[model samples]
Target: MIEVEHLSKRYGSAPAIKDVTFSVEKGEILGFLGPNGAGKTTTMRILTGYLPATSGTARIAGFDVHEDSMAVRKHIGYLPETPPLYPDMTVEGFLHFVARIKGVAAGDRANRVQSAIQRCNLQERRQTLIRKLSKGFRQRVGIAQAIVHDPPAIILDEPTVGLDPRQIIEVRNLIKSLAGEHTIILSTHILPEVSMTCNRVAIINRGEVVATNTPEELLQQLTEGTGYELEVEGNIVNLTTYLQRLAGVRGVEQLSNQYLPEHRHKLRISLEPGQDLGRNIAAIVVKSGLGLYEMRRVQASLEDVFLELTTEEKPIDAEKTIHTEPAVDSASPASDSVVEAAQTTPTTSPTLVPESTHPSGGEDA
Candidate 1:
């Protein structure tokens, strides 16, 4: 359970996060997303009690982050973007050291350290010096340290930043496996990661949370209505111009990459969101002597939401589904429950996420 109320942070005249408020419920994974310098890490550090906000407050497990930082720290595990590794120490020794610092009982420290090493797939590297290990192993060591005390919640800052594809998946899978027993918050810039690993996402932009909602909700809210994507095989020039002229239509933007440089007869058209212009556009294209290859509504996606919420004054269709919470949510206020769950559980799986909760793929409970 976590609550961040009107959180703001500043370095002199420059602010990092401003008027940001959100919560994560027990057992849910809240994906923190943003571009570099978007204040993602700043918010995370505040939540984990690693950094104090210039103004505003954060609470962990019902304990105020600033007033009860020590108590809050006892309930949460934190791993920064760069793995904080002691190059001189072996993996086991480093983990042992972290366990003591985290206040793990001396009697159970060895077992807890071993369990962390095992769960993070660091068994083979347990005796190796942290500095000598590969980047991936070093990351695992960082994770091991975070979990050595078995805190109820884990906050991971850019967990996959420098890993290769395979290692990225490995780390993601490991995070996923900790569901139900350990609440986790994973921050990353990759949009697909939020869709794939989190139950909900909060996008921070320009030092403020420009948007906060499940991926799908944000997309729906951003879009004014439904739209279509078209691919034509011939005469795109006249056809595209014709489609732009139809009534109830907003505009048309062409986005295409020929399969090969030698290919030039095909075009991909993204219809601006508005009324039912697909049929009219279709008629015009066929009449123009161009063979239509494919025409279908482009459902709202995470990218749509990101673009719409981050920028202003872009026209959009109104038919998009942005009215209600995803069907899977069984909680009253989404922020409250999701935030609470973030302490004790990491969500079930890809399918368990609340329905209509994401831009495209579904999340598991």
Candidate 2:
């Protein structure tokens, strides 16, 4: 479980994330979506205890990320944009090393390493050196190290960034499999992956959270509902007026039928939220003596929602516009409230690795 509230982060006078807030329910995968420079990585770093918030608070498994950084780290497994890895170490050896560093019991290290290897589909590469592995395998090794300790929470930032298409699907499936057992926050630029892998999504723009809800709910909010496109042949002079009078009908627009045979017309009908009038439309067309050639349903997509929310020059008050489920407080399960502004604060913390060690090594913060 994870809870973040009124978290903000600023560098000098510039803020990277302002009043950003959202929660990941236990066993749920929340997609953290945003355009470039929208403070996604900033938020991830703060949650992982790799950075501290200037204000607000974030808790993982009931421990404050800032006040109890060590405990929070123990409860979370993080995979930064670049995975922390030891190029010279074999997949199993690196996992063992990570397990030790993450405080896994020495007696259980072998089992944990093997489990991580299998979970990440690294059986063949278990004995292969990380440097000798391909990019996909290296990525798997990164994930394996992150889960080697089996932490309850996982923070993955661009986990599938550079992998090939097949590799991307493999990683996506791997992430989905981890859901129900680990609370995950996945940040990526791939919209389709989010739609397929996430149970809910939080869209951020210009350092502020614009909307947070299920993908379907967000789509509904944007389109107000689905619509239909119809192709018919008949007297259409009063068709628009007749359809407009129907319950739940928002508007009807005639699409150009220049290429169609004479008397054939195309119409696009918009409907109010939660309304489905396909049957009624068909019945009316038949009763009116119109020959209905085609009828197709149209709905808003995640890409549409993302563009609509992020392209606005002004910040949107998520509570006032979008429908969001009550966020449960990890500290108090009975308390429910809408997610509000929470952002990361800029604070210096000790790096997870020493400068003398692998300089290119990623940090599993």
Candidate 3:
């Protein structure tokens, strides 16, 4: 429901975002990821009409963000990095004011305000002044305001920042629930947020989009530093040396030697991406007379793609070298679904290859 083409923004001689482009599908939660100074907030501001782009076209639900500014604003709800809240206003009063400003019908204003308050779990604090609420509660109030009008799309910048773990989970669940009803462009640096909450992700770096795809598809793009972890019961002191010498094996690092019985050891095995080393490693362990208690294939994650994309010094062209992986065998679930995105050992860090445009757009510094 969003589109951006060749979007760019500059301040003085330096560019904040250059040729930034990306799109978000209807009813999708797209994580807009980038490091500091990578222009994420700049892009969001432009799309929300708070800032203008130097040059480019941005459309929201077919409405031109620039030419149809009012129309676009009507269809979108935006929460800036720092929530704009009236500390003196009570929660109910604030939401009622927001509903009016967002143009909710007079007859429906009460319902909309109540729905927002309920959805954000602000019932207990609806009578409390915003200034009296904790940071987490205030954040919920900000989100409640954004959705009070029930817009078609929502642009959230760091929705979970400053929240405690419990608060973060509450907000995360709330965001997930909003999908299908409201298209969301979630801009944040928290990798796990993208992995757990978003259907797809866009990584921007050096004022440009470097990658865009589903989290799983992007993880498959890693060409190195993919492998497994093993817990074995053995006494071999030279296992690391042997594993390293094996074909396709990149490196072996012993993580721990602790065991009550003193026969078990845990080690991490690094391999080239897409390498089928599981059977070989298992066989080697058997031949070495070690009991393989567990072996779980490591999977790449959004963080891996983010670090690879943003850490690079050069700009990446999203049009080329970014494609989804073909059908491949899925890794067996031997461990938690949480991907350990540790840097690949003994291999060059993987490079991010972007494919589609994510409509992050652009804005001035």
Candidate 4:
């Protein structure tokens, strides 16, 4: 568990993190998301005791990060943006050294080192020098070193950044397997990674936490009355035009690629958030005599939430037409409250809403 209160960090004159506060729950995977220079790495550094905060307080499992840094470090395993490694050392040698420095008991050091190697699947490369290993192997080496001591929490900063797709998947599965046994804070800009690995996410923009909740809660917060995509065999007697006139129907997109020539129109319909447009849209297609091939809800994802939070409010694109049936009277604000944080200070992120927070559009329900 972790807690930050009124945390801020300044570099000379400008702040890198400011008045940022949040908690990382036990056994939960918390995704730390933000654009470049979002202070994600900076915050992690402070929590890991790699860097000291400019102001405020931070606590790890009830130990003050500033006062009891060594105690805090004893319970946290951190893999930074780059894994610290010795190019000439073999995997087994490196892990053994890490276990010693982390204070593993002399009698248990061999078991601890072996456990890390097995968990990271480095058996084949145990004798290979780190500099001679592949990028994926190097990443695994970093992770193995971090976990060699079996710390209670793991901080992986961009663990999949340079890996190929398959390598990324491997690391992802590895991280997922570590959860429940180790609390993790996975920091990355890749939305798909968070969706796959984390239970909860905190969208950090301009150095502040703009949004925080379970991945599903965050998606559901933006999906109410979003849209539906339907692929069908027929335009069928003007059904598309008629569906446009139905209540809560905002807009329709017709896909016109050469790949689908049989009946040709694939409709992507936008509707009032929270409205049941699928059943209504289906009825129109049936009544108009069109053959429906596939229909499903198009939920707004984590990317949509990140952009909406990080990007400042701007004028709508002029070429795009705005369509809407009506605003749902059931709309609710984004979160529970904006209470004063009780922990450490952090630097501010560059791209975000103004200092005075604005109400978010959808309800989590």
Error of 3 at 161 (Å): 0.4
- Candidate 1 Cα errors over 4 Å, as ranges: 224-226, 233-250, 256-284, 293-299, 311-365
* Order of quality (lDDT): 3, 2, 4, 1
Give the alpha carbon lDDT tens digit for every residue of 1-365 in model 4: 87888888776666777888888989999998888777788888888987788898998888998999999999999998889999999999999999999999999999999999999999999999999999999999999998999988889999999899999999999999999999999999898999999988988887788888988777667433377777777533255556565666777756543577766556677776555555556766665567787887776777777777788974353223324332322222211010011011132332111021112211000
State the lDDT of candidate 3 residue by residue for 1-365, as single tens digits: 99989999877667888998899999999999887678888889999998888999999999999999999999999998889999999999999999998899999999999999999999999999999999889899999999999998999999999999999999999999999999999998899999999999988887889888898888777434477778888764544444555767777766645442577877777776556666666766665567888888776666667777777554443222212231222342311111111112233434322111334333323
C-alpha local distance difference test of each model: 0.71, 0.78, 0.79, 0.77
Give the alpha carbon lDDT tens digit for every residue of 151-194 in model 1. Answer: 88889988887899988888888888776678788888887778
* Per-prediction backbone clash count: 33, 15, 6, 25
Candidate 1: residue 145 lDDT (0-100): 86
Q: Give the TM-score of candidate 1.
A: 0.76
lDDT score, candidate 3:
0.79
